[model samples]
Target: MSEPTPTTCMRCAVGCGHLQSGREDGHGVAEAKGNPEHPTNEGADCQRGIEETVDPGGDRLTQPLVRRGGELQPTNWDTAVGVVANRFIEALSNGGGDIAVLGSGQQTTEAVYALGKLARGGFGTRYYDANTRLCMASAVKAYDSAFGSDAPPPTYDDIPKADTHLVWGANPKTAHPVLYRWIAESAAAKDSQLVVVDPVETQTAADADIHIQPAPGTDLA
Candidate 1:
């Protein structure tokens, strides 16, 4: 095996640093571990990060494909690029009524910025949105309303210092295992109270000092 390459895990927005072990032949990642020097995770990793590094190219599209006779067929990159460019040009010439870009929050910050620039600056389209809007709109709105901004006030470092942790509708054990470990460790060390409010009894809730199972959509009430 070759030397481990230090990289960040982009599996989620948390941005956990990882040291990936790969071959010099550049075939694929063999194994990975958390980077101890990372500020965000600090030698902690989630299952998703581990899975991603192990099978980085599983079920991935290596070549571009185009729909032909109602079936997607592999095609050359030039042809694929031409097809998409032609469609975008046609849409622009026809007043861009059907031109829109739908992005994902899973995309890297650079990727998201490039897409935004392409949509707004290159295509001049206002019909650009991301899946983050659907997933985090309510939470962002509440934060903005309360704090006049959508930024999260607390960092992961604050977990250990907090006397009480009130987790709502988030399963850190599955969704964010690294942070969950910190929270669990803090609770154990400080004997801090942990209040979990979720419709389902999740793993995090199981370890909580108080688990409040509110009815679906009735948490605010």
Candidate 2:
């Protein structure tokens, strides 16, 4: 069999490289082994990659669908596009704050930028927010306090080599399963200490060397 094209996993932000073998819609399979040449994954694919072979394109929502009589019915692409565009234009002119655009930081960099421009520039709305705010805000704030900027300095590879790890207010196991694998590997093989602080008792917290659960809404205290 011929080799498949190398592409990154769109499933999550890990962006692990995968070899996809097949057409866009037809029967196909993807084999995901980490791209060692990749600066991040280092030839190690996590659970999502291993499971990509099953239901490679099974659950994807392709084509446009609209709810008619509370039932989603497939519609032509042009018709769906027109309807959505018209509704967006109407919302802009209707003078209502009820319309909000939600974006994801896990999206590709270009995809995020395009969505931002669509909301802030094209639609004249300033309520663009990424899901990362709820997950990594404290870590970002901590970095900004010390480095004078909010930026992720080290990649996943660096996590395994770091001496100290501070996981605050985020759960990696359920939310970021792949990254959690790296964390566990780091803690076991590298002797890196894990410190988790969260209000909820998450899988990551259960595994941490030091787990601190403060009172709800008392993160500042």
Winning model by lDDT: 1
Point out where model 1 deviates above 4 Å: 1-3, 21-28, 56-59, 95-97, 146-148, 199-201, 213-220
How well is each residue in 1-221 modelled by candidate 2, as lDDT tens digits? 33666667676776766665664555455344566666555666666665754455565766679888999899999999998888887888865343578887567778888987887887777677876575569878988987887886777768878776788898877766767778877876656788899988988889889999999899965
Q: How close is candidate 1 to the true structure, as a TM-score?
A: 0.81
The C-alpha RMSD of each candidate to the native structure, in angstroms, is: 3.0, 5.4
The lDDT of each candidate is 0.85, 0.74
Model 1 clashing-pair count: 0
User: Model 2 clash pairs?
Assistant: none
TM-score of 2: 0.60
Lowest lDDT sum, 10 consecutive residues, model 2, at: 23-32
Off by over 4 Å in 2: 1-3, 11-15, 22-30, 52-63, 92-99, 132-134, 142-149, 156-221
